[model samples]
Target: MTRLWIPFITLLSSALFTNAAQASADPLVTIQKKWAQCQYQRSQEKQQIYCFEQLIKRNQQALNSAPTRADLKVWLAINKSSLAGAQGGIGALSLVEEAKDLLEQVIDQAPETLDGSAYTSLGSLYYKVPGWPVGFGDDDKAEHMLKKALAINPNGIDPNYFYGDFLAEDGRKKEAIQYLTRAQKAPPRAERPLADQGRQQEIAAKLKELQ
Candidate 1:
């Protein structure tokens, strides 16, 4: 298994959080900022673990308040998956399992929510988790879900990056480069500087390695 590595902030809309400067009061926006900080800024394993744990609590509270919100469900799923990656072990399996369930619900209820983020995140999970009895990793399913996300948001940075990364990991470097280049040139998210910077660094590193 590759571990559940995926972006916390995928292709999202401004309507989800409103204007960046005025979104400080929005719970989802707060969750997004904290997730970016934890995933990108924090380096220490213990600190990262702590950050994700806190994020999970906050996300859960928000979800409880807005049970019908698919976006909240997606954030909760992301928090759990990120925590699973940080807390690697057999124990992490449960976290990802729950995360998978939550994502499945979002996909069922609103596959296009957050601009197809559920598909992107779910696809990442499928490839990253262990396969067979241990977990549900499946390259075929990963590719399918990733392609679905790409279809919904073809030019989005996260979708292109994820699909490209999937190709690269599968030994299709030439195809990976094409999608990665598009991701590199994808327009920036005005509200997520930290996430954009961090993901760009990751894309650059992957491209460098492939080249």
Candidate 2:
């Protein structure tokens, strides 16, 4: 799916880099942090689009350097998805399709990468996009992927939040509230204060609507 349904997501590495050198040393971590900034901190539509495009390019270069790196591929897909969300239109579908392919690659190579982030992201896409004839949206596949993510990271904020959101969207408010509540109580990420805060606000908003 695009950004509007479920915004671009990146899981923060547990280790927090203290300096620019440390940040640059890990291209994946750097891109993830930048993604949070672009997704949550930026407000201007044009700027957000530019930011996502730049990240996508940078991520693609990283992937080129390390073709076998599933993590890099995952981030590249996320940036592409974000860009698709920002520049919505008939054209956006192509970007998301590209993202879907990248994510699928990650799953095939490393389903356990980033605590099953590929599953969470892929599941979100399945539900957010339109159904066949128009898009490839499928509720059953979405549930399957989301559940796989949940099984991998039971207490993860992203998985729970996303599963809850999926359930809510499907008109299952009671179950959605339960997962959302667990997501709200998930531990904070020392490396991602901004993302944690932004996500919490989103969870709160979702709960408010469901309740």
Candidate 3:
């Protein structure tokens, strides 16, 4: 299973917190900053696994301190998801299972704190993992999770774009075109260029295929 990891930025929107400079620092914010740093490290392709593990450690500490903060829980889950990808790269199935358990906990707690972000993550997990007789990917589970995400936030770019990718990979050409088109038309984000361009290309290609 080749995991498609979503960037942490989408899961932790600036608007979700008050102005960072003006707001007093909390354990949640501190952990979030660490997680953001880890994401930056991953992007730079430097010590990806170690950086993510550091993020997990920080988030775990924060969660222990303030276990009720839904945001921290979700962020922890997101970090675990990234860690699973890192583990997969190294052929570590055991680590992937550990990460999956963390994600499930996040979903069980609050699926709405991150604007249906958890569902998008889980959907990608199911979509990317290789299925039974071979591995763990389950398209049915992927579709269910993606649909739940869409229901929670119909106009969300991440779900639309990723779900489009899932549909395309599953040979549902028309549905894929629809979702990719929706993603391309999504509200602009200053920090999500890759997601924006990827959806645009997906839409264009699927549109061509249908025609």
Candidate 4:
């Protein structure tokens, strides 16, 4: 019953966001909220794959309508990555590559969009994806970009959390703990209640493992 309710509620919430996005004049605001909704539903992969796929189309339309907005590109890229993760197979590589391309543009053309989120996200992709012929994953580059993101948004939860995860993966347990702890204490984003709540849970889980 609980598991069934989880997806039922997720679909209901997605419908509400869809309605709100349709009513919204500003696609950027709509995309941001919708992206948040899509991400929160991410734990339910098959369900979110469908949800985010629809969102990807909407985002492409939104981006086409206003190509000047870098943030839109960022969110679109993020939604793609979200979709790719939900898929998680050889076929998903294309989506990851697509997102990488979009993030590169955001980094070059709009580093400040969403407070250096491009850097953080790009860095994450580098570390998370495979290397060489398959993808462009590179630890050194990831570290450099993640640090740059931190420089731009020192107090941001994502930067700290990702850097901490990177550190943990690299066996720097103490350092990872420091950053993870900071991420746990980072300020909440009122505009992104769902994402904030989800992230806080992730931060807690990461902390538990390291501690």
TM-score of each: 0.92, 0.91, 0.72, 0.85
Stretches of candidate 3 off by over 4 Å are 1-15, 18-46, 133-135, 189-211
lDDT of 3: 0.66
Best by TM-score: 1
| lDDT of model 2 at position 95 | 86
Residue pairs in candidate 1 whose N, alpha carbon or C atoms collide under 3 angstroms:
none
Q: Which is the leading candidate under lDDT?
A: 1
Q: What tens-digit string does per-residue lDDT give for candidate 1 at 1-211?
A: 3544443334454335446566876788888888899998888989999999999999999999989989989889988988888888778889889988999999998999888998998888888887888888899999999999999999989889989988998889899999999999999988778888888998899999999
Error of 2 at 172 (Å): 0.3
Looking at candidate 2, the ten consecutive residues that score lowest on lDDT are 1-10
Q: In candidate 4, how many Å is residue 8 off?
A: 23
lDDT of 2 by residue, 1-211 (tens): 2324445564433334588788679888778788998999789989999988888888889889999888788778878888877887667889889989998998998998888889988988888777788778889999999999999999999999989988998889899999999999999987778889888999999999988
lDDT (Cα, 0-100) at 106 in candidate 3? 72
User: Candidate 1's error at 57, in angstroms?
Assistant: 0.1
lDDT of 4 by residue, 1-211 (tens): 0000011111001112356546466676676677667777656677788888999999999899999888778877887887777777567778878988998998888787777888887777777776777666788998998899899888888889889877887788999999988888888775567777777787798789988
- Give the lDDT ranking, best first: 1, 2, 4, 3
Pairs with steric clashes in candidate 2:
1-125
Stretches > 4 Å off in candidate 1 = 1-22
Clashes of each: 0, 1, 3, 0
